[model samples]
Target: MPKLTKRTIDATEPQVVEFFIWDESIPGFGVRVMPSGRKSFVVQYRAGRRPRRMSLGPSTVLTCDQARTRC
Candidate 1:
């Protein structure tokens, strides 16, 4: 995994299958690239032993810094 950054996020290319690129610096913070070419920022964590994932927003609408702040 690479550290999440504006440049890296902007440069990411969508894959045939949806995949996630995790942030090396922020645990559980990552970007999901879908086959439809949409990118979304997400944060994963555990709440009372139940794992959960939340989408912050599309990468086009939110910068890496903003998503990191939300995380």
Candidate 2:
């Protein structure tokens, strides 16, 4: 995984954005911003031959450390 770049994404009070990391030539990991401005970490791994979407949960509800543990 690559380093995440911190930057402002939206003008709203709850800003939403995304940070990506390349793993083994694939964008296999990233963090997504929710409408509430919460940051949730995500990992895109293949389930057999198909891709899957997994939620790490809301930022306030789950800390980055917690989300990482989920991943």
Candidate 3:
């Protein structure tokens, strides 16, 4: 996806299955949208050869800028 922005995030509608939108500017930084319509900021990185995933926080609690900074 494009850069992580309020507009882009807001414009994304959830589907029956959960989906992810990764930030183009920040590698591994992204947002996850659940089928329930809940949104949260997330970061995915490799811990050595193993991949790790962590949730920054809910989008309702953190802005895109804040999440990007945390990433």
> Residue-wise lDDT of candidate 3 within 1-71, one digit each (tens)?
78989898888899999999999888999999999999999999999999999999999999999998898
RMSD of each: 1.1, 5.4, 0.7
Candidate 1: lDDT of 50?
100
Query: For candidate 1, which ten residues in a row score worst on lDDT?
Result: 1-10
Candidate 2 TM-score, C-alpha based: 0.52
- Residue-by-residue lDDT tens digits, candidate 2, 1-71: 44432332122244444443332333555566555555655777889999987776754476545656677
Candidate models: Cα lDDT each: 0.91, 0.53, 0.93
Q: Who wins the TM-score comparison?
A: 3
- Model 2: residues with Cα > 4 Å off, grouped in runs: 1-27, 34-38
Q: List the residue pairs that clash in candidate 2.
A: none
Alpha-carbon lDDT of model 1:
0.91
The alpha-carbon deviation from the true structure for residue 41 of candidate 3, after best TM-score superposition, in angstroms, is: 0.3
Q: Measured by TM-score, how close is model 1 to the native structure?
A: 0.89
Answer with 1 or 3, whichever has the higher lDDT: 3
- Using all chains and alpha carbons, the TM-scores for the candidates as numbered come to 0.89, 0.52, 0.95
